[model samples]
Target: MSTSTLDLAASLRAWGVIRTPLVRLREIEPSGVAIYAKCEWQQPTGSVKDRVAAAMVARAVADGALPPGARLVEASSGNTGIALARLAVMTGHPFTVVVPENVTAERIQLLTAFGAEVVFSPAEEGSNGAVRLAERLAADEGWVLLHQYENPANVDAHAVTTGPEIVEELERVDAFVACLGTGGTLMGVGRALRDVWPEVRVVAAEPPVGETIAGLRTLADGYVPPIFDPTALDGRLLVRLGDALAMLRRLVRTEGLPVGPSSGAAVHAALRVAERLPAGSVVVTVLPDGLERYLSTRVLELDAEEAGGLTLW
Candidate 1:
């Protein structure tokens, strides 16, 4: 390897933009329960998916699967697409993102703004439809598909970096909670924590079926991700849309964290698990992204009737 390339690879590990802060949320729950959140939204691409995107691209290049200036394709709700779009540009690869038609205008605009080719799948089918369409495109044109839903690197990124970061900071984790999308974070982080603490409870926080909560998916949905395994989780918590919205508001006001709906849902489930645990138990949750990606949606603009029924669960 060239001297310059070796230096670049070595310095990449110490890059300041790659690390994010972990916040210990004391006021969000009872005195006995301690809730720690990994604020992944502070990443360079503004989401936890940045880690996955970087890993996938690096592996593809190293394995000679992706040539210089190759074109790439992927299916994402918002965060992953945006992360890949940014990375593709930086790495001199053209990217095409197939997303749900119902996604907020803010996300669509951001993807296009990053110079990514954007395609809209059917709104009724949600993210699953985007996956189908992207798969077809990948097969037809021989495009390099990052396939986050099935990629092992997606899980590995969290297992190596995100999970160890939490274990290092908190020392011990009684319970680990994360929203279920493609199951990368839950599976990767869960396995990492279990390696250290065999009794650590791995919980999944998912939105109720038939709800339009972005960034989350229920297992009841017809298409289960290839990487998802029910046996990996200790339990699953169903979060309602109204309750998630309420928690979003509370988090912004009380904790000063303007997190996304999926994050709010994860926090809600974490608090539920915390309530059942003994005093001084530690619970860690992953906030996948912040509110910047959901500004054009109803995430922060709930009406009176909608807000009234949602009690903090």
Candidate 2:
């Protein structure tokens, strides 16, 4: 618990809350379509979930449900847990994160280092198991449950922050691409884009069944977060883990951006969208996190065959 409230405030200061706009990639080879990335990975928690966590905690506090020093609790798939844990520490509240056992060891270690108490849910069951366990615990103790999967605050994060930032960054964004996890980023940004430019295509980069967070996949054997609406997206594409990893390497090797798996997935989707568009099309992709957290997995070592059976969960 050495991370003081001052540390959180200092971290927040390091990042200007009014996030910078998307930087246009004007230099791709055979440059017809331009691709830009909204670097949410640069957020304090190294995940876009930081916005949602901030929104969730602030909203709860505003509603008088969570007073100062109250405990916040939830189940997470790493990123959200880390964001909320940081929030709890900053807000003078405490938090317990219920997570599946199989999440990246780095994520678990990071969460623990941030002073969040961890409760391991069954890895086989995935995030849903954590959700179920969290629900029961919340019910039992009346904890302030920031149920992100269904929380409107999650959507608001993108709606108010990320969406506008993308629009401001790009001159003419033909399409928006992002990975679909809780569906907040896709839906919120989709709505904003459609409201502003109805012609803008909202592309969802979904993980293949094997690469998804367990129980979080509605297409496979899992539970869909209620907030997810298939019809909300203008387009949906499945990004393979191998192609995603390769793209991640490509970005790092070529563009010097060290992004994580979800960013890789979004970049793959961006390229696919770019392929179909006319010349000079602008495609913007949101990067969820940085690559520093993924080194333990040796993502670069994955070949097509080996990447196939390796579940991203």
Candidate 3:
């Protein structure tokens, strides 16, 4: 008889799946703020969602939601698809990811390489289009949808892994900054940190109201992830795609951190928070992913009003 298969989380950590550490930086001071970045983009799948995806698929297997040979389906910007696909390959499940056509080719190539079938939505409509299409597919096909938008596993991943790591590394974090996607990372991490220090502020960095950031959709675009509890945040701010991209450059040049646009937004927001706080207030930011995944867009360089009208944003 064959031995029982290994549990996904245990196997990963046992195999030395790297843990992202909190790296503290010299005081970019605003009186109460000391900036730190939890470089989660450095995770195995190149994004913080890797934790969410792993938790998601593993829970599905245990709960019988995703049976052996069950087909998993969902929507993504880029990083989520990549994360889910990598984990699906690990758990021996078949998955189909729906994404906007405008996402980075690196994301598509990585998803395909990891054995996920990708369906592209209309480019101009962005992630909103992908969301509608994915919901339609799930309804018609009755596929097991690991809806990251509302997935509790997404929040739990941050609560368990990301938040604790930050707390362990810092004596006191006065403010936490996160890129607002489906609001999972921010809400989850914010909740965990607040439990220890209720006064610690949580800030969200969102794409400029009408614009898209990475492959994420927004509340105004007509959907909110069920996992998102808006009251979780202390404040929310918008970041322009260009400003975010520029901050990525500064991060690499000034700090040697090559993170993605969402991460850049966090940094930009963190700096803003830093400017308003008292000296020595610990400010921690979660950078969800890296820039290499968006190389096709030249997120580092730009010309005219549009980058390339594709990956540029």
Candidate 4:
């Protein structure tokens, strides 16, 4: 690589948005299947969105879309906003994020800590509302909107980095599971994995219609991201909020993995997929973020009744 290219790579690594570990869950082993998780919370911003944010910012800079002192804005439930806030600081851009008012207090606090302005959308409308509000704000204020839902950079980030990392570590992957948000992770990683294991199943774990799981969305709920290709998925598992929380608790208590609700949902789906596969099948899932962002919400204390309902699909 050229000197400039080498320096750029070092800078990205220093920013803590590079490779993360793909670890086997030695304790939570199913009968004949091996399960692994990509521990993405290790990133500086404590979420897998760090990769998307870094890629979007770098693309914006290279394309000259982000001029000197340009303002940056995005719509996020939590992780993406926090990740973008940190990148905005590094790039010397003023940052703003639109989020549902019902998001956890810790998320708001983290965004503020990174000096990003927070705008509230109607909580009842969820993240789709946040996206609409962000679009208006970006247009009104002339802020550069790094729209994760439509941004190719979001998928490209995972395709180039996250997917390759997993394939490098695992010689054969039977199935890849992850939460369905903007669909970037599944789409990007799915494509990469398929390149090696042509028959590898790409599955998505999502909340059922009208249900809410932290950092997850269902396409049945009206808004499907433009980048999402439904044909790419082998299966779409509808995981309930309560079931996801139960799985999250299991990971923390049994597996010693302190991951967020989305991670829990992904693992829950992964296990379901594993049960149908042949013995010795390798199932890998992405843990999008850690538990720290959920501390203020008392997530660990939440019981099944308090967490809503449980259903498997």
Candidate 5:
């Protein structure tokens, strides 16, 4: 369906967007230290990528790079594709998402439910495989690719919106922790925080090299997102899968926060940062998404022997 520029604006207005909340974790923080979590799951698609998707599509349309009703293609493990799929439907454009076969079953179902075409790349190659496949498809078929890994719009979205929200809510941020995925959140929010308070430390919670954690990536994994700058980070901590999963359970049981694995990793890193800081320090982190999409992954489940659950807490 060919859509005119006039109709594009109308289509865009039909969807409701939101400014997600920033909640301070006073109850869960150590004495004299404060930690906050920006709740991105409150977005339209229940993920932070909602901001990225909206920004990318709107900018494409405004810049005339994306003609009305042009098909958009992307590679994602889940959240970005889900956000793009919802936006594609809203903006009267069809979208195609290429994902690795190992992505959670819920994500595939969510993409299908959004009426977007889903293609599976090899699981062994992970997101890079999906990227390779998407690049080929976009080149061969003339589909416009919204390459989130390299898109300036992804960074701009967080800088213009998310960054200000944090600075507005908190008096001062001593450290900002975020997982390293496409690096948009880390780079954009880090820059904004540093611009406001030059001493704000930007820390990264990365999965161990050669280890797998959904929605987070290690730099040594062969594909570094173009937007990522190692120099911007004041510190980098390696989160093991076991530790991340353990934190996920702890957060759920103790704080009543059922966030995904990457969020857990960020929280773990944030806590460590808080421990070393002097009293009255503030640290902010991001909770990217909720547990709904990740239930199918065993990270949230117990083994048959421990099916009754960990009772010793």
Candidate 6:
């Protein structure tokens, strides 16, 4: 690796993107069944995507795919874009993010704050449209598209960092649960946990078909991320928007954990898995991001009647 890439790596470490806390949710689950969450929101950018962004950039730089000051582009709902934007600033790379127009205002502001050019895809088309548009723009402008959905580094990031951290903290993880976006977290961490406990169940919590959760997707929604392997998962749970919202509020009010919607979906699924497992079973889940990004959207503040009509971005 070049000196610049080395410096970038060092900067990432200095910025505190590595080794988030694996905290047990003592208040959220039964005493017999233990539930632990990887507090990824503690990352510098307050999202698990920070790890992916750092790993992707490092690998790209090392591979010479991203030479010094090369422009970077990506499609994100929010977290990944914000994460890569911060890294772009550190590396002196011009960054652009293609996002769905329906994304929260806080996300757009954060991207702009990091000096990233933001492009909006049609709101109705959702994130898939953003992905398509980003690909076209990257092709036309010759920008480096760090497509997180298919990036091998996305999986490698969790495999090396997130997975290892969980293994080191827990004696046995009978089940691993996470929200399914690009499926990198579940795939990578599931593989790692399974290596130690071969029977460890890997489950995904995804939104139902045609419904949208902030950072999760149903495989039935026409785009299966290339890095996702169905064989890696033991099961998939359909978490409704209301259920995720309710659980998000529960995590905040009951556990005092300010986590995002995806984390809510993850914990919802984790609870289901925990209920079915034996008394001594351990369940681990990933809290992908923080609640700050969703504040403008008022997801947490929605009343039950208002929540019924809520359209998720």
| Cα lDDT tens digits for candidate 5, 113-158 | 9999999987766778788899999999999998999888788778
Per-prediction TM-score, please?
0.89, 0.88, 0.89, 0.91, 0.88, 0.91
Candidate 3 TM-score, true structure as reference: 0.89
Which parts of model 2 are misplaced by more than 4 Å?
Answer: 1-21, 25-30, 209-221, 304-313
Model 1 misses residue 243 by how many Å? 0.9
> How displaced is residue 225 in candidate 5, in Å?
0.7
The weakest ten consecutive residues by lDDT in model 3 span 1-10
Model 6 residue 197 CA deviation in Å: 1.4
- Clash counts per candidate, in order, are 0, 1, 7, 0, 0, 0
In candidate 6, how many Å is residue 116 off? Answer: 0.2
lDDT of each: 0.80, 0.77, 0.76, 0.84, 0.80, 0.84
Tell me the tens digit of each residue's lDDT in model 1 across 22-114.
898866976788999999888877788888887677667756778988889999888889889988888899999999777777788889989
Candidate 6 positional error at 214, Å: 15
Q: Is candidate 3 or candidate 4 better by lDDT?
A: 4
Model 3, 214: alpha-carbon shift in Å? Answer: 16
Per-residue lDDT tens digits of candidate 2, residues 1-313?
A: 2212223322333333437346554443236888888877778878888888887776676567787777778998789998888888778888899998877788889899889999999876777788899999889988888999998878877876788777766667788888988899998888777777889988889876345444444556566888888888889998877788888887777777777877778888888889899997778888788888877777777775655443342
Relative to the true structure, candidate 4 has a C-alpha RMSD (angstroms) of 4.0
What stretches of model 3 exceed 4 Å from their correct place?
A: 1-17, 27-32, 212-221, 308-313
- Compare candidates 2 and 5 on lDDT and give the better one: 5
Tens digits of per-residue lDDT, candidate 4, 1-313, equal 2222433333456567868989897766588899999999898889999988887787777667889899999999888999999998988999999988878878889999999999998776777788889999999989999899999888878887899899999879999999999999999999989989999999999854246434335556567899999999999998877778888998999989888888888898998898899998999999999988887667788875664421111
- Candidate 6 local distance difference test against the native: 0.84
- Which is the winner by TM-score between candidate 2 and candidate 6? 6
